[model samples]
Target: MSSRTTDGRSAATTAALLAGPIVMTAGMAATPWESENEITAYQAALAASPDQTQIAAVLLFFGYALMGLAFLSVLRRAGGAPRALRIPAATLAFCGATMLPGLVVVDFYDLALIQSLPAEQAAAVGERAGDYGLQPVMQVPAVAGLLLGGILVMLCAWRSGLVGGWAPALVAAGLVASFAVFSGVTMVAGASCSVVAYGGIALRLRSARIPSSPPAARPATA
Candidate 1:
């Protein structure tokens, strides 16, 4: 039983070892999607080509699903900080749910684009916003999910006792402030925080092979 438990721990450590790089690559994938032309092209292609929507949706779903798994793993290995994991896991689940609504809305957007040549042009312009007919409704959940996710991420970083602790916390706090300001700063700050939190954890884990430091050698007793 002891050996089996040790082996399980070893495997989890190894898997966590690889998680950082995998998420780093996902960060790279996300950057391209951020570009205006890329988003516009992504939506336009989905509008013009039936296969594109399927491919894009599959890829996006896979990426997010993988991220969810990674976060869950982090939570599991939190070494007594279960609260840290629960908040993040719940937030991520909510984000995943929010994205599902877009699945239906994007199809509608594409159909609308195909209805007319000039209308397709309008759709391409609107693609930058990625606003389907349902976006107004979708935005509420999306924003809420994102803000909550940021808060959870900040909590994780705080619990981890990593460097630049204030950054994540500040970013999360700034997002909440922006919500009241109505300046769209929430979106910008929240996304920035996600990237920082993602990349920061990857870098930290890479540098610190052992998730927790070794116990200090005890002083000689009298």
Candidate 2:
């Protein structure tokens, strides 16, 4: 494809990636409860409005899938880095992205179990699910993937001059801040920074002029 067409594709990918965060935010908003005690409340709410929980779970699943796409696109845009940096970043990002959808699945299962089982059985199953299910197994690693992968991507972008100015720094800072407070607000802050960083990358790639092939090296003097 022509350079112009390639740039357009990259810009479109970035735009689609932007939707990931928005969808995730919407999923969060649609969530029925904030705490374990609230699970009972959620059960009550679900009885009155049967579809809401399912809809929220589906939305979360799509959000995570979009996040995976956005992450992979960012890695593609950061291509040409040293293998040492590139490999780990890609691996970690991939692990996180792959596991994200699983989280939503586990959550939905938990909701369904609660809805379908007796209270005693539901509680027992929930505890076992947390202790034995794939969700807990993958949660920490997925978190590590996003955090480490994001840091590596920022570093690679800075090194390659693919992204300059304050955007990379802001992205890195936001990622760090998410861990610092470990709150919902911090999560939103981190996601916002990511959006800004990716948006900046999209604009840069869209506007960049394609470089022609370098002239052949000169012969050495006798």
Could you say which candidate leads in lDDT?
Answer: 2
Candidate 2 lowest-lDDT run of ten: 33-42
Candidate 2: residue 73 lDDT (0-100): 67
For each candidate, what is the lDDT? 0.51, 0.68
All candidates' TM-scores? 0.47, 0.70
RMSD values for the candidates in order, in angstroms, are 7.5, 6.5
List, residue by residue over 172-207, the lDDT tens digit for candidate 2. Answer: 788788667655566667767777776776666655
Per-residue CA lDDT of model 1 for 130-166, tens digit only, reads 5567666756655455455545644665566543576
Model 1: lDDT equals: 0.51
| Clashing pairs in model 2, backbone N/Cα/C closer than 3 A | none
Q: List the residue pairs that clash in candidate 1.
A: none
